[model samples]
Target: MGVKITGIGSYIPSEIAKNEHFGKHHFYNEDGTRFGHENDVIIEKFKAITGISERRYLPKTLVTSDIASFAAENALKNASLNKEELDYIIVAHNYGDVNYDSVQSDTVPSIATRVKHNLKIEKPTCVAYDVLFGCPGWIEGMIQANAFIKSGIAKKCLVIGAESLSRVVDPHDRDSMIYSDGAGAAIVEKSSEEGGILSHYSATFAFEEAHFIYFGESNNLELKDTRRYIKMYGRKIYEFALSNVPDAMKTCLDQSGISVDEVKMIFIHQANEKMDEAIVNRFYKLYDRTPPKDSMPMSIDKLGNSSVATIPTLYDLVLNNELKGYSVKENDVVIFASVGAGMNINAIVYRI
Candidate 1:
């Protein structure tokens, strides 16, 4: 038996937070020192580096689980599968659900359970859970689903990556502008078809990188509050990703027995444009070739970094032909890769 994504979907929030929107906000250094450059200059530099001009923000009335369910419903429809037949529901995220007006996150009932509840699935055997492996959580969830299906524990699984990073960001931190909110999901199931998940790799480098991405107080220390928000060492993450991610992708592709020349596309996490390009370039260099034009389709320009939601969402967009100039056909080989908190990294070599 092989594991394949039979269907996919994504929820791109209607509300757009343009870079221009941050113009009025005060950005400060980690030490709470005001930036020497004005907000315009900072935003311009940010756009140049991250390639994010605007990002989607979840509406105030909805929560992470809500969007996750939306994406799940769409995927179910796309697959033409009955919801009651699903054997597992996996939701990947970092923060649970943070209200628009509050910093507290709600995680009592797992997001998967909430999604199952939202879908009104009554099957008691449809086990639901959540994975918090940082931005790679979604791909990790897919790996687990593949394992379950291969082991005869499941026939079908709904794996979702959803996050409201906007709800967890510190306005005082410039990195806050890099975050957004969104959800993406896929229906993975057993298939008799020839091509499916061929190989995968995962690693956690927590020895010294454990806290590279963590929660910390606002950059504006003048507030004097204990509430923490999403924080990270940007330079550290960039260097770490460049040094490690390409090797991980190469390892995954090699395990699949697919040569570098056969890869049609690579759905990498939409963390930063420059960082992603660097990783792909390094991966190609591993085989003594440069990356092919249009090999990487990026949504980061408009979606920002929505934590776990990036890859699946981008895949969904490309599949739907909403992402121009990128398309995948039957029997195509592709790679899915991501790096994030836990200082974790993972890659999946898949055949379409």
Candidate 2:
């Protein structure tokens, strides 16, 4: 038995924030000190490095669960499955809802619970929960669903990645610009077919790099704020991705009993265009072959990095043929690779 993705869904906020908007604001260092560089130069370098032109963010009134339920409803609809039919609803999120005036936030009822409430799911047997595996949370939720199905526990599961990064981002911090808000979800079901979720591999490097993406202190302590926003060590993460991520992808592909040439497409986390491209190139080099052009499609140019939502949202785009020249057909091998906070790195191989 295997588990396979049956449907995909996504929700992007209507608000479009361009690089210029961010340029208008002054960013500060982690210590709250002001940056000396001009905003234009900084944005140009950011675009050159990350390839992000614009991104979406939900209205401040909205919360992470609201974003998730939108995607979940669409996913269940796409699968022609009702919410009551779901055996599990797993939500992956970093911060719950920080819509309050204070920096303090809570996930007490769980994001999954809030989504279930949003969907009005009446099935008592349906389990609703949340996962906190950094940006890989959604993928980890999928992995867990695979285990549940393979072990004869669950038949269908909904895995969602919803983030309100704008709430957690330090607007004055340039690195905070790397994030946006969005939600993506997939419906997975047990299948007797030979191909579905083939294999998965992941690792947590929590030593020196653990603090690479952290929430130590607030850059802005004004406005009665006390929330810890996301802070990333860009160079350190870039170097880490280049060094370790490719090997993790290779390990997943190797364990799947397939080679680099067999994969029809690769869905990599939209962390950074350059870093993702380099990692894929290195993966192909392991087989002594050049990486195929456009095999790895990217959405960071417009969507920015939506954290855990990136892969699934991109997956939805490809499935609907919304992406140019990137589509998933039957019996095609696909590889997914991601590296994010928690210092988490993981890869998943699937056949459709």
Candidate 3:
């Protein structure tokens, strides 16, 4: 049986924050070259660089589950399915709601339990689990879901990618400017059709790149404050993307028996506008094609990088008819690719 995406949903926090408003905060320096001097300059830069003007954020009262729940409910509604029908739920997140009781284990079951109770899913026998792989988490989730269905362990599954990067943002650092809070959900079920997840490929360069982008604790006593924030060697990370993502895409396409030219769209992780351009340029040079114009659209300017939520949010935009000249059709091949912390890169082919 083929695995197919039955529904899609996305949630951006309700509080909309513009660059101008962000600039007013004292932590934002007017002469900071990282983001530019003036609010207008920064906003213009964000628009020119990332194609994003504004993004939403959750209120203090809301958590990652709140955002995921909204998206999950909407996904089920869009799919015309009940929550009780899901045999499994996978919550892909790097950061979850801070709960005293739920600190040590996977947060998916907790989030799933909330969803089940909210929907009154009395007989839901869903196995809920969490996956953390930076921006590649959703692709990993898709692969795992396919395995579950193939193994007859699950017939219907809900995969979600939700994050609240705002909580982890270091206000003093300009690097954190692009991050925001958001979530995306998808309903996947067994199908007889040809379109779905076709091939998955991923690789990690473990040596020098390990320090390029990291978010966990550090061994240095003097760097204790760094543990609480996300850190990145931006130039190094960019170089890694330039070298690795295209190659991963090529491998994924090869495994799927499809050439690069056959791909209608390339959905690279919405990491940054510059990184996206670098990947698109490499793809064009390698394939002699124009890199599918508008293929690497950015939500970073508005939403920052929502980690795993990037691809699903982009998918949601497509499903809502927000993306121009893009529509999913049977047999159409789409490439989902990402490079993030852990210095990891992944490419997966999907037939929509």
**Candidate topping lDDT:** 1
Candidate 3 CA-lDDT value: 0.75
Instruction: Assess every candidate by TM-score.
Output: 0.99, 0.96, 0.86
Cα miss at 34, model 3 (Å)? 12
How big is the positional error of residue 289 in model 2, measured in Å on the Cα after superposition? 1.6
lDDT of 3 by residue, 132-197 (tens): 778788878887888899788889999988888777665555555677788899999999877688
Q: For each candidate, what is the lDDT?
A: 0.95, 0.88, 0.75
Candidates sorted by lDDT, best first: 1, 2, 3
Q: How far out, in Å, is residue 91 in model 1?
A: 0.4
Q: By summed lDDT, which 10 consecutive residues of candidate 3 come out lowest?
A: 26-35
TM-score between model 1 and native = 0.99
The candidate that wins on TM-score is 1
